[model samples]
Every structure is written in structure tokens, then in C-alpha cells.
Target: MTAPPDRRIAAHRPDLADRRLEGLVAAGQFVEGERWRIALASVPLRAAPRPDLPFETEALRGEVVRVFEETIEGWAWGQIETDGYVGYFSADALGPLAPEPTHRVIVPRTFLYPAPDLRRPPREALSLGATLALGEAVETRGTLYRMTADGAAAVVDRHVAPLDAPHADDWVAVAEGFLGAPYLWGGRTSLGLDCSALVQLSLAACGIAAPRDSDLQESAVGRPAEGPPRRGDLVFWPGHVGLVAADETLLHASGFQMQVVREPLAGAIARIGAPRSIRRL
Candidate 1:
């Protein structure tokens, strides 16, 4: 018999499943979900349809989700296209799919403005790795801003890089930039994030794709390494993961400290136990 699907990434439930899984899984009904785009800066993707449910992850602006079901209570059951994470997203956070994104946010976070002028009150802050479909450029007060494809907002040009731009040479430095960011349970933004999210977001800025959870990342991110950990090496424990910052320092979003921090490898091992594996990119 085939193994059961991992529910975190599988678009399946007892009552409904993705049309592609019709033969492999049992469900009350199968549907070919419609594509939708995240319209807000960020929105929680919860495991259940209730507001009280802790988020499983977060969907960032411009990401696409395949929505299979919608409820009158403002929940939309869907799977994220980028990470294949399955969850219930707030219906209001989604909109009709827009034009393909041409650029991606390269900074930790940036403000979206209502006009090209930076002096105007900002609209929202977009997190790193958020994709944007940009139109023409406009300069005001010596600042260059790129207008959204629909002309709904503007973003500082330097804050985003073209989709085809070369990746960062030092992704670890990218991760280090988040030092002191709050450790949120299931967040994936610069405002707040979890351990796996720290890895995922940092790698994404360097043009690498990663799984959404620590266990999945531990298995899929890179090849195994067997020596002293070096910068950028991924260190994993049973339910957690971190990156080697230096010879003996580990950089991670620590739940213990409620923030991203750099701690000695020996101290981390003492607190969390020996690492299960270490992998190098």
C-alpha cells in the first residue's frame, strides 16, 4: 500500500481533496481549485477555519494559492503554490490573480507607499521575498520608486531586485540580518518568524527553495555534512533547526529567548540536545 500523504503539504481532508489526488486519496469530493493571489502584505494560514487556531504559516503578498473551498465564515481552504503548504487562509486576504511578478523584495522589510513621494504616509510594509509586479518607474525628491502594475502602490526601487537578478553570495549574512526579530510560532516575515522560517526566508532571498517546516527542511535542504559546522551549515534537532553563524555560534530564532539570537553551539546543544544532523548548502 502507498504511504499516507503528509497533511501539511497535501491538499486533502476527509471531506475534500485536490482533483490531482483523486485516485491516491479518499475524499468526499475532489475539486480542481481556482488560483488566487495574496493581496495583503501578510496573512496567517491557519490549520483550522477558526480564528482561534494558531497559524500553520503565513502567506505573503503576490503568492498564489490554489483555493479548493470557501466558507461563509471568511475562511478559504487552500494550498500555497510556492511551499505547497495546506491551510485555511482568510478570504479577505486573497484577490483575483494578478500579472506575473517581475521583482522580489530583497530587504528585510519595506514600506509600500500610496505615491512615489516618500514623504506621504505609507500604506503597508512588505516583507522580504514578497513578489511584486511592477510597472514604470517614477522619481520624486531624488528617490526612485517603482509603481505596481495596477498603479495601486509604489515601492522604493532599491528595496526590490528583478526576478532574474543574481542571488546573494552570502545567504547566512542575510539570515544574520534578522538577529533580534521576534520569534513567532508560525510567522514567516521580518516582523516575526520561526526557526524554519528564518532558514526559508533567508534562502529564498538567495534564490533557493526550501520546505516549510524544520523536519521537511532537514530532509530536503542540502546534502549531509560530517565535520565541524561552518557558516551557512544547517544544524537540526528533533523539532528545531539553526544555521552555523561562525566556528561555534548558531544563529536561529530561539523560542527560549522569544527572538532570533546567536548562541554558542555548545550552549545550544546543551539546551536543545545534540543535533540530529548537519547539512551544507
Candidate 2:
């Protein structure tokens, strides 16, 4: 029988091992090129080049990726630089490589305005952690404007932070802000985020490196916390995780609640079952 259609395509790009391509590359018959940058707000990285298929991850705007192949149907097979994730992305979501980012959005989402005028419509909305090239800063009528990549500009309020800003000391506060955000299986942005994505993004904002999925996160980050759970600790189940808000509380993006929420740890354990492990970072 034929092998099942490869679901691991998004995790491991086996297509890179095509016999013909491998032969050509081994014989020094391939070309090299620079990586491309994502231009759209966010693009899904799917196992295959189809919208109906499931997506494994998302490439945020301004993220760079190295393309391995481009199909006639307008999809590009590539590796995302931020997380080394491999999958197929829409070619239309990319642009020529640009300079490194100078700033990162701090708010859940903010609008990119075409001009400084408030009455004018926005060019687009940028999600938290979305990076952009910096340009001149201008202030008009008591409002400050910061020019962004592609000549777009956003009001330079407290919504955006310098790329080099210090890591947050209280990560719990950061995760708590998404208390009402909708749940999306593969989403990482504030627009819609899943449990693991919420944990990853919140920790990332605090300058902690995190993997995309819960199991990898449980393996890669932090050390085990001894005794009773403490604030800033992490709790893990089979495929899920929650952040400790206090000795008896957990803060997490719950698929069951369909949003982020704070709950009593014992109650969560009863509903989601006992945790496999607890850790501290």
C-alpha cells in the first residue's frame, strides 16, 4: 500500500530529499539565492500548498524565510528563520528581503495609518511582536508619527517598543492581557491565539526563547520547580500547558473556555486532568 500523505511535511521537509534534486545538488547543479521577507500581516505555513489543509505555523510580517522551491500554483516551500519551521507559504505573502526590524509592536494590535491624520483610514493593523523597519519620526498636532516599512506610518504612542527593550520582569502580567482573546489552533498573534501559542508569545515578549508547541516547550525551556507551584512556574499535561499565576492559580489560553482565563489550579487539574510535570523558569 502507498504511504499515507505525509503529515510531517510541515515538521520535516522531506521534499528537500527528492531524488532528482538531491542528485542535481550533489553534482553541484543547483542555484543559491537570498531569503525573502514576509510582507503581509501573517501567513500560514501549511503541510501542503493548499488552503483546505491544516497549517502548522504562521510567518509574521517582516520575518525572513529561505525559499527552497516555488510552485506554479503560487506557493513557496521554505524555512522560517524565527523558528526554523518548514512548510509551504503563499508566494503572494512575501516580498523582497528588507532591512532588519528596528521596533516591535507592544500592543495586541495597532493600526498603520497612511498619514498622521486620525480621520484618515488605516493602511493595516499590525499584531503584537510584529517587527518593522524604522523611518523618520514626526509629530503633527500633538500626535507623534513613526514611519514604518514600505513608507507606512503608525502613531508613535506607547503601543510600539524599541526592538532592544529590556525583557519584562513580570511575565504573568503579559499573559494576563489576553484574557478575552479568541482561541485559534495555530495562531500566535493577539488576533486569535491557542494555548501553546499564548505561552510561547508571552514568554517571547519577556525575552525568553520558546518553541512553537507545548511538548517541545516542556522539553526545551526552564527547570523544574520544587514543592508547591509558585508564580511564574509552568504546568504541563499531554499536549497542553498553563502558566502559574499563584500557588493555586493558573493562567492559560483555554480551548474549552474559547479564550484566555485565570482559574484555580486544582479545578483545572480536575477538568484537564493531572499535569505530567511542573517547572519554573
Model 2 ranges with Cα > 4 A deviation: 1-14, 17-34
C-alpha TM-score for every candidate: 0.98, 0.87
Top candidate by lDDT: 1
Q: Over the stretch 1-281, how does candidate 1's per-residue lDDT look in tens digits?
A: 99769989999988999998888899999999999999899999999988888879999998999999999988999999999999998899888786889999998999999999898999999999899999999999899999999998899999998999998877789998899999999999989999999999999888899999999999898999868788899999988999998777999999999999999999999989989999999
Tens digits of lDDT, candidate 2, 1-281: 54432333222333443222443323223334248989888888887788998767788888888777788999987777776677888999888775778888777777778886666798777777778887777777887778765566665656777888886777788898888998887787777888888888788788887878888889888998899999989899998998999668999989889888899999999999989999899
Task: Give the number of the best model, judged by TM-score.
Answer: 1
Q: What is the lDDT of candidate 1?
A: 0.93
What stretches of model 1 exceed 4 Å from their correct place? none
Candidate 1's displacement at residue 189, Å, is 0.3
